[model samples]
Target: MTDPETFIRSTTRMLPVPGVPEIAVYTADEATALWEKTEEQLGQTGLPPPFWAFPWAGGQALARYILAHPQIVQGRTVLDLAAGSGLVAIAAAKAGAAAVWANDIDPFARTAIAVNAAANGVAVGLLPGDIVGTAGTWDVVLAGDISYERDMATRLTGWLESLARDGAEVLVGDPGRSYLARDRLELVASYDVPVPRALEDADSKRSSVWRFRAA
Candidate 1:
């Protein structure tokens, strides 16, 4: 298998995120093609899609909100969970976060985050594993587009709730994914986030940012 960075550079183009023009990340031209290409490159089958190659709607929305409202993360330590492409993590750093960590379970995603963060001229620490059930001292925790699956969403929400209770401000950005725990969150902001037609049902997703309520 080729070095992940080399494969990512060959397969994607650095592009500015929609709505958030201050930052850019490596993005694939098409999701399905990239998914297949990733598998072929790794000599693997049934691998997850290359999600780190695109700026998802929820991430874009969250990035826009953070850039617009820099006060949210300014001078605070932040963690971007499932930090695909490091989009939101870059936003936090650009918004003046004291320190930012981009956390993702995928090794490919960790490499992609490092690449994208360097491209965007921000220093971000890459956390390469599942830290969901663990406690951290981040002043702010950001999650984007994470509620797409039933069981995963349930587990994540539980962890996020615990984070909130521990005094970390937890925020979520989502496009009405079926499992989003609205009952445990309060709306902070909303936007019509631009999305790739190949990846979403529509060209734009009405995404919302929510603050997890400590329960």
Candidate 2:
């Protein structure tokens, strides 16, 4: 595979998201043209679509909440699981977290996280592979939009529950996806997030930030 960092820098532009103007990210301008440039590099018709190339609604909602309530992460060790675009991790750093780690399995996403964190003037550490079952060492663990899949939500929620049991605060942001088991979570905040028409069917989504309650 080609270097994803180089591909991302060339294909995307740094733009401020519509609602979350405080942070700027390297992302696609339009849905149709998002990954078109990568086609030639892969020499194939379909390459894995880059999730890091856009600011997802769930992540945005979580990030916005964190910024608004800096006390949640201030002076603590924080982790942003499935840290797409490093939005929440950057927000944690900006909110005064002593240290922040952005975890994602995708190499391109990791590079994007590094770039996005730097662009936002925040330094974020990287956890480049899946750390699902591993015990978390941070004070707070944040996940956004990772529960869209059945198996993923099952696996991740189980692990997140464990982290919460160990006394680390676990928070998730989701737009009421099918996989999120709401009964196990406590709603902490809600936002009407504006999403791009191409990404979401609606102009805005009622997204919620949930805290993993005591088991």
Candidate 3:
């Protein structure tokens, strides 16, 4: 197996994210080339898309919110669900969270999180594999760009709502993804998140940070 961390570092450049410049990430300049490289080197035909290779609109919005409102995570435990590239997790840790956990089932994503967190000079705990139905040990649960897929969104919404019922502040960063259940959430913040044109319809998206309310 290819050393995912090493491969990521070699294939990508450490670029400062557009809105969140406090941290840097190893990102592919072009998505197609990266995808082809992954296939050629890894020989893995059926792998999850490399969500870690770029800063998504939702994650960027969430990170900006956390930086602007540090008190939300200060001295608290934060879990960034489906933590692609560890952007929001790093932001929470930077904003003074007592502990920040970045969770992603993909091996590449986990490796990317570790590398990105280290690059940002933050200590983010790694949650390997799925933690969808786990205990509500986190003071804040953040999900960014997770509602793009149907099956995962179904599981995610139910689990996040459970955490909300347990009194943990649950926030979801979304860019009007097809699967987001808007009725279950209330908006807390919105941002015009800059994103790659290939990944979004426009140069930026009007993403929002939505709080999950009790049922």
For candidate 1, the 10 contiguous residues with the lowest summed lDDT are: 15-24
| Candidate 3 weakest ten by summed lDDT | 40-49
- lDDT score of residue 201 within candidate 2: 83
State which candidate has the highest lDDT.
Answer: 1
Model 3 lDDT, full chain set:
0.91
Per model, state how many residue pairs clash.
0, 0, 0
lDDT per residue for candidate 3 within 1-215, as digits (tens), equals 56888899888999999978887999889887888888878886766678999999999999999999999999999999999899999999999999999999977889999999998899999988788888879999988999998998999999999999999999999999999989999999998978999878689999999999976
Order candidates by lDDT, high to low.
1, 3, 2
Ranking by TM-score: 1, 3, 2
Residue 159 accuracy (lDDT) in model 2: 96
Better of 1 and 3 by TM-score: 1
lDDT of 2: 0.88
lDDT on C-alpha atoms for all candidate structures: 0.93, 0.88, 0.91
Best by TM-score: 1
lDDT of 1: 0.93
Which runs of model 2 end up more than 4 angstroms from their true locations? 36-40, 43-48
What is the TM-score of candidate 1? Answer: 0.98
Evaluation by lDDT, superior candidate among 1 and 2? 1
